[model samples]
Target: MAQLQTAVSMIYPPRCTTCGDLVESDFGLCGPCWRETAFLGGAICDACGVPLTSGGKDGVFHCDTCMQDPPPWVQGRAAVIYRGNGRKLVLALKHGDRQELARPAGVWMANMVRNLVSKDTLVVPVPLHWSRLLRRRYNQSALLGAEVAKNLGVSFCPDALLRRVRTPSLEGLSHEARMVALEKAITPHPKRGHRLDGKPILLVDDVMTSGATLKACTNACFDAGSGPVRILTLARAVKEA
Candidate 1:
């Protein structure tokens, strides 16, 4: 079985989905490419987990945006900041058919969720609309959700929330526009209320930009009777001027 797998790999030449370089091992990222990722560290927002630019006087760190209006999710954690190699990796995974890249990224996200979430929490991925899922061939958030659930010994529910409409890409939108767009895009699953009663939820996603998407999803989950939602993502984009 090992030899057959190796033979298949050699014929296929497994490559880093993020960088398109031949993978030196099964780890997905080449050594140097791995070093380029800027994982979030040190003081971070207690609500959204974006690295705080300055510490708060009360020792309670908060990003300026979070202080203005806390997101619907109770808290969030991200594996890395969305810049440099982290941005490239997420884009590749989402649009470049770099499905294999999800492995390492998912594993890292799973570890983070495991540490933060309680054992009984249910894991749910922020869902993609049917149109987007068809175009992408996979929901990156669901892929991460599955890995997180497996490693953490929690139940993974990919259908707990639904995207009711396909909105325009948020790439160039202002934060307010992104929030409005997401508000019109998502809704609760009909049956999720039955499944979510009294359950804490861990919401998984690929990357967080302004957190509008996650916040929308969290509201849907609450409508479906879920308890407080905590968000986990592979990357978080820094606030830009």
Candidate 2:
């Protein structure tokens, strides 16, 4: 058995999923690729997780956008920005064959939202429409949420929320337009709403581009009686002005 295992390992050696560098484990980036990924840190927004780099002292700070127009979710956290190596990793997971990255990405998200996770909390993924799911094979958000939920020792409710309506792609759309497109697009599953009631829902997603999608999902959770919906994402794009 040992000899056969060694032969198989030699036949299919693990490589870094991002840059294809030789690494000790699969689904990782080489040192340079890993360093290039911008892992967000510092005094972040209490609402949106935008880093507050202005001259204010180190403490809880909300970005100007979030301050002016807070999102529906109680708070938000992200592992990185949607640029550079961060974007590469995200694309690899979503488009490229890097489903293996979900483990590390989910672990990072779990640590970032550690403060908000509780015993009664439920990790809920923003759903993909049936058509999208069929094409993508699996929802990246659901994969990440399930991984994080395992680490948190809480329930992972992949179907707690459903994307009942399918709309055109939201890329390059204005914030208002995106919101309009997602109007009533997400809803808590009729039978699953009871499971969500009174539970602190940690909404998970792959990215927050403009935040309209997350906002819509948050409304669904709240409308179904979930308590204090907080958000976690692998990456986030600062809402366009």
Candidate 3:
């Protein structure tokens, strides 16, 4: 049966989830499309995990924004920079319902966090408002979080956090406006059943844009007795304001 399915799929090859081009490989992305993504390189910014250029003087590596007001999360890691094919891939997984992309994306993120986090860590996804979830059919962050937890052998808590507000689309907003929009957008689940008390948490999200969303979610996690919060994402948009 498996071989027959493979033969049928080969006859009608599915398009690459990222580029929408005919996929030649079973892995879902065309070779050229896959080769275009540049995963985070060495010496990344500790705050947001954007790749850093070599410094001349002090041997320090810091993105310009991280040098200013630092982010609230203890550590952040991203599988790739959000540009070119990377951005397209993330959008497909998120809005296009090509969720199969989550498997590899989540594994890549989990491997990045394996040494940094432990098996005991709990996985929490940045929550989406109910209205948004209803429109989207599924929460991409939750799907990614589930895969990451499965790969890391950690507990996955999908409802550990909840969103309190349904903010407008964040595109074209200033950094301050984005922060304000996310402020108080997240809160702890009221059921009190999924206890995060004294447990470390790894927050999963599809992309790390301005990080306002992650910061708000992490603050709520800390308030609910979760330990230091670390973040992992499929992509990290360059911080250019």
Candidate 4:
């Protein structure tokens, strides 16, 4: 097996996940692309994981938007801020059919929320409507969530939540509009909902923009009797100042 693996690597050297540049490792970014990626650090919003300009002496801090409209989930963390190479990674995994990216992306997300995972934590992903799932052939969120669960050594419930309604793309919608469109669109899966009972949940997603979809998923987890729920995303979309 070791000899076969070496032959494969020799035939096809590993390339950067984002830019297709030759890299020394598999499922990783090259140095230049890695430098350009906006990995999150410092103080971030407790509700949504957006990096804040100030750390706030109190040790706890939230961005103005999260303070005004709190997220449905208890806490949130993201591996990267949505921009530059970070955005490229998200778009590639989500739309460019780069399913293998989930491995590294999930590892990043798991590291971000490592402190939140418990022995009984269950990893769940935002669900896609049947039509969308059929069209896309796979749910990006589920791929990331499963990988996170594997890295964390926790149970993964990919279908714990189900998208009941087929909603339109919310790309250009306002926050309120997105919420309305997603209203009751997600529900706990009838057969799998039992897995969430009293379990701390680690909700995973590819990206968070308005967070309306995550809000719906969190509500479904609570409705299914899940314990404290936290969210993790590959990237957090932040507005420019």
Instruction: Name the candidate that leads on TM-score.
Output: 4
Q: Write the per-residue lDDT of candidate 1 for residues 123-184, one digit (tens) a residue.
A: 88989999988888899998888887887888888888889888889888988999888875
Instruction: Give lDDT tens digits, candidate 4, residues 73-114.
Output: 889999998999889888988899999999999899989887
lDDT of 4 at 46: 80
What's the lDDT for residue 107 in model 4?
Answer: 90
lDDT by residue for model 3 (14-76), tens: 887666788765546677877888678678876688887765246446677877877777788
Which regions of candidate 3 deviate over 4 angstroms? Answer: 1-16, 20-25, 56-60, 192-194, 239-241
Global CA lDDT of candidate 3, please?
0.84
Tell me the deviation in Å of residue 22 in model 3: 6.8
As for lDDT, the candidate ahead, 1 or 4, is 4
Could you tell me which 10 consecutive residues in candidate 1 have the lowest summed lDDT?
188-197
Clashing pairs in 4: none
On residues 1-241, what C-alpha lDDT tens digit does candidate 2 reach at each position? Answer: 9899778768887787677878776566688877888888877787778766663445667888887898888888999878888888889889986788899898888989887778889999999999999998999999999999988888989999889998899999999999999999999888776778888999999998788899998999888888788999999776434
TM-scores of all models? 0.87, 0.91, 0.87, 0.96
Q: Can you tell me which runs of candidate 4 are displaced by over 4 Å?
A: 55-57
Ranking of all candidate structures by their TM-score, best first: 4, 2, 3, 1
Clashes of 4: 0
Candidate 1 ranges with C-alpha deviation above 4 Å: 1-17, 20-24, 56-60
Question: In candidate 3, what residue range of length 10 has the lowest lDDT sum?
Answer: 53-62
**Worst lDDT 10-window in candidate 4:** 52-61
